[model samples]
Structure formats: C-alpha cells, structure tokens
Target: MATTDDSFNGLTEYCEDCDLETLHEVSVQIRTESTKEENAQFSREPYRVCECQRCGNRSSQRMNNA
Candidate 1:
C-alpha cells in the first residue's frame, strides 16, 4: 500500500517570497464545492491564494468554473 505522503504532497515554503514569519504571496490549489446541496454542486478546481504567516492575512481569488 502507498503512504499518505505519496498521494498528497505539500510544498513547504516553495516560494522565495515566503520567509520566516513574514508576509508573502504564493499560489496553491484548493478543492471547493459549488453549492451546499450535492445535487446543485458542480466540480472542483484549482484556486490561487495568498497567506501571511505573521499577521495571518489570507485571501482567495474568485472561482473560475470554466
């Protein structure tokens, strides 16, 4: 059997902008649902997000389902 790490891998500080406890901009893929109801939901896609380690500032870009 394969391990969890083999399936899902995370890039730690992959971006040069991200420093130790500092504000930085990075891109990440996220899975999301379209609606609360399963029937109404559509599909999942990758999203770009920005995060700050020091101030804990996090934001996400608008979903583009196309």
Candidate 2:
C-alpha cells in the first residue's frame, strides 16, 4: 500500500541515495495557512511524503493545485 489516504499509490520517485528511480510509499499532508486577520481566508497546501520501499529513505514534495 502506498498510502492510507489514497493520495498517491504505486508510484516511483527519484531516490538520491539509491541513485535511481525506486518504488515508494506515498502519503499526503494538507497544511492549512492561518492569518492574524479575523476575517482572513484560509488556504490548504498539500505536500506529498514519499518513502523508498527498498532503501527506507524519505522525501517530501509540495503539490501545486494550480
């Protein structure tokens, strides 16, 4: 299983330590932005966290919704 949230599954990403593309288990985290303004709107930023299945290396990337 790639993730429990079903964001990214069965994907291969670049591993710097492995020096090649390898299969990774991916998980997503949505970070909410907060402002000091009482009426300020909030936005969510999604980040994908990847862990190499072979080498146990972890990496994260920000996702662009636009």
Candidate 3:
C-alpha cells in the first residue's frame, strides 16, 4: 500500500541544471481519480516528487507499483 506521508533521501536522478546524475530528496504522493457513480470510488495512483541535491532542481514522474 502507498502511504499518505512523504519520504526523503537516498534517491538519485539526472539533473538538467547540473548536467549529471545526483542525489535527490524524493517523496511519494497519491493521485486519486473518482468514478462516474453517484457515490464515487477513488483509485490511487502514486508518483514521486524529486529534488536534486546539487542544483535544487525539481521534477515529478509516475511510479509503477507493479
């Protein structure tokens, strides 16, 4: 299950500003979508928000839970 809280550290990704791969602070957040029913049902999709340690650049991408 994906958690509601954010997590940080131990993540590395490419930074455009730095022009290299660097460490990052990563957090996970749930993206919810509602169904067309009267009482809507929500589905959870998780994504990661990453901030580069070197240049402080930030980016986001969808996380595959499979």
What is each predicted model's overall lDDT from 0 to 1?
0.50, 0.72, 0.68
Task: Give lDDT tens digits, candidate 3, residues 8-59.
Answer: 5545666779977677777888766556565344466778887877888887
Cα misplacement distance, residue 17 of candidate 3 (Å) = 1.7
lDDT of 3 at 36: 58
What's the TM-score of every candidate structure? 0.41, 0.55, 0.55
Against the true structure, candidate 2 has what lDDT? Answer: 0.72
Scored by lDDT, model 3 comes in at: 0.68
Task: Give the backbone clash total of model 3.
Answer: 0
Clashes of 1: 0
List, residue by residue over 1-66, the lDDT tens digit for candidate 1.
Answer: 111222223222323344343434557676655666674335566787766544556666656757
| Candidate 2 off by > 4 Å | 1-9, 33-43
lDDT comparison, 1 vs 3, better candidate: 3
CA shift at 5, candidate 1, in angstroms?
A: 32
Better of 1 and 3 by TM-score: 3
